[model samples]
Target: MHNATVIALRTVATILILATFVPLLPFEAWYIRIFDFPRSQIFVLAAFTLLIFLVLRWWRYGIDKILIPGLVASLVFEAVNIYPYTFLSPVQVQQAPADAPADGQLSILVSNVYQHNVEHQLLIDLIQEHSPDILLTLETDSIWQKGLRPATDSFPERVAIPLSNTYGMHLYSKLPLRQTRTRYLLEEEVPSIKTYVQLRNGVWVELHAVHPKPPVPTEDDDSKTRDAEIVLVGKEVKGSDYPVIVAGDFNDVAWSHTTTLFQKVSGLLDPRIGRGFYNTFNAKYKLLRWPLDHVFHSDHFKLVKMERLPHINSDHFPILAILSFAPENKYEQEEPQPDEDTAEEAAETIEEGKEEAQEEDD
Candidate 1:
């Protein structure tokens, strides 16, 4: 409805007002976790819908030099990861050796390899060149799994759960994988691998490998369910005995509020802040980029080196990080957010959710 300039102005104003709520503490960004869909799906759709509606109205309103540019700038600011948010999060570091350390720190390679991508040799070459202690592969099917038999042979131990579905995952480790289990974070077969690894200095670190469902509109359309699964894991690891390390294709960006809460709740740190946002997805796009992959750790680990490996056949470039032990002077007393239960609000939200679920199930 390209009606009048005044109507367009009113529409733009409404969109900006809505965007403001995107970053509020718990209700806007984190509340999606309470739903059954993937968190990113909810986030991306909501963002695009709002953006498109605003842009169309602004065009119709016709204050070209002022309102339209302002709207574009605002969208860039909202989505782009600029300075201040640079690096990523507490991924900040204090010091490091100029040359490679005499003693090697544990290096972890987390790659989604894209189930349909057939450049297995390229991946193998990269793995051989890097020789990381652990490797995590997502979206691996029987065909992909069959291709990596040789690589798995090199590692003494591995856990493979290959499915034709894209949710299939596998992990190969050089060290003894003690009590490792393949866990589903939600109803989908998105598998997260958790196990303990003995580092060179005799310290043990708990590692969790994850591949949350992407937020795009497919079978799983909601982002709340996926986010809830991640939040649930963060809740589980609070006050855990060993240091923790989590890696995988989170399907969300580094700067989202949910990610920040995850870091706070688990007492983990991102290795990208002040370092770089090694955007791993859309390797083909020259400009449009998002850091959808991640490596997060508890306070005990000090980031040694982190980088985005060269692109293979997948839409995602691999991410690798080497971390060493850095014991804390005192553990964080911080409590995780999004745990509110005001009866009035919860009653309404819960009732609404039950009604929706019943409608779908029926």
Candidate 2:
């Protein structure tokens, strides 16, 4: 190969490899954390770069020292980070018990209906069509709440906290709700809903719906608040004796460090473990999508069904999941357990969030 061509290839490969290191830094800035959303894309790019380097390289110079090792490391890191979300990985949550009666099943639909989105009827129609037992909507405001009221009238039990700041939440359930409250976990402007709902079989299940602010230049400068809110929920649900379900657009990917910590701390299992990345955000861009919407459950519930619904004029695609409460299947699934380091990190993150909130209050 020509000397100029060799130099160009080495430079390109080096740049790609270096880009993968952004997520490894122990920083939560939006510029760095955004790298965590595209591990799959990064893996594809790194693998392609490695293949090109292998086929076009010569042993003429010491280029091998810099380019080859870097490319290899990048490929390995990306693959390891994204491997769990692939089909080759083992399922984290087991299927619902085959013999469990239909009465034990709970169907839920969660959507982050972008506030400025004008197509309110699309969401209303979807709700009527799916008729899920519980409907949780985020990014809702007064206009959205009023528009959806008629369609959701059948959902007699409701909790609505409408705001125009794009942090609104509304939860409607057909089942009877016991002790439902809208709490501001970290930021008072951001609301989270917690309630105990009765299933058809007269069994009670605790449910939490949350939409933490995304770590972006426009939304939040860092991920501390988002991480803290998620960690707090995880810690709260960890010791719960009742079956628990936490669902919504978390504004973070399933494989992120904070999310993994959340699962381990809460003893919750993501239904997308062995399943494909049901990429729900950035509905307009196919390649830029990730699984921002999630449905996690405790061991007492098994997955009856899970799916990513079609896009509704919003930037996010809705998610629907049906879970069955069968104690027998609890042993079939494995729950995540955080090691000493992760536990300590979570506690520190929560404390940091508390201090920041206090400063803002003062």
Model 2: lDDT of residue 16 = 74
Assess candidate 2 and give its lDDT.
0.88
Task: Please give me the total number of clashing residue pairs in predicted model 2.
Answer: 0
Whose lDDT is greatest here? 2
List TM-scores for all candidates, in order: 0.74, 0.95
Which residue runs does candidate 2 get wrong by more than 4 Å? 1-12, 58-64, 97-99
lDDT of 2 by residue, 211-307 (tens): 9989998988888888999999999999887999999888999988899999989999888888778999889898898899999999888888888
Instruction: Provide backbone clash counts, one per model.
Output: 12, 0
Q: All candidates' lDDT scores?
A: 0.66, 0.88
Clashes by residue pair, model 2? none
Candidate closest to the true structure, highest TM-score: 2
